[model samples]
Target: MKYGVYLRPKPERAISGDAYTIREAEGSVLLGLADGLGSGEEAARASRLAVACIEEHASLPLVEILQRCHFALRNTRGVVLGLLRVDLQAGQVRYAGVGNIGIYALTREPFHPISYNGIVGYRLPRVHEFVAPYHPGDLFVLYSDGVNGAFHGNEALLRTEEDPQEIAGTIARLYGRPDDDVSVLVAR
Candidate 1:
């Protein structure tokens, strides 16, 4: 799979409160994005903790992984997180998320997967896992709430962009808010 990531902090902040992880293990690709409850150091810590949990438990089931993240983040500021596991051998994608993180599938049949409303550590709603077939040329985009959700309208750019890095950079540059931490991850 080809993938790219872009991350930036609010203009006045020294570090972004957003964190992400991409890992390949046991015929699957694990992708995760976390936005801490707010910006700056504490938020960054929360997000980092979430991503670390994901990396440490990449082999677990989606729900289990998230559950671990929830337990691990209890003392922190909490975070909104999105997790996707692309099962290459099974030709399917399994995803679970909580809060405003957006996951967009730009494939022959495009669709947006739903995320439950809640924060990971503070108040987690019942988790639901969404599954979708993975095609050869499918593109998956995940971003934090700091990114403008309306950017999905640029399907042409998303579909045709050769470099995944360019796609991620463009989206963050055009749609990301300067007052919040921004993160975008693109994988195909």
Candidate 2:
């Protein structure tokens, strides 16, 4: 599978409040994104911390990593978290998330994955894992709220054969908000 990402800080802030990490194991890949509660350096710090935790424990279960993130982030500003793991050998995806990060699976059909309502580290709700069928060419998009939430499964965007980076960039440029830090990650 291939993956790509694009990010931009809120125009008004010196640093973006969003952070992300990607990890690949022997037969699976893991991706995570964190969005701090507000914009600026402090928020960036919080999100970075969350990403660091995710990267450090990529070998663990998604829920375990998130649970660890909750504990790791208790002292700082809280953040919204999203986690995705693709089992290449099994041709499936396992997903778990909290807060407003937008996630969508674009295959021959479009479907929105469930994200529980809560904030990581502050008020996390019960975490539930979701499993979905994945194919070689399936497109999965995970984005922060700074990017427009409405473009869940835009066919024009998902159907293109462009590189993942180009796809991420186009969406970030076209749908990102200037008042908030934005990030878009594309994976197959």
* Per-prediction TM-score: 0.97, 0.95
lDDT of candidate 2 over 17-119, digit per residue (tens): 9999999898999999899998898889899999999999899988898899999999888899999999989978888999998887886544457888998
Q: Every model's Cα RMSD, please?
A: 1.0, 1.3
Off by over 4 Å in 2: 108-111
TM-score for candidate 2: 0.95
Candidate 1 residue lDDT tens string, 33-124? 99999899999999999999999999998889889999999999999999999999998888899999999888655455888999988998
Highest-lDDT candidate:
1
Candidate 2 local distance difference test against the native: 0.88
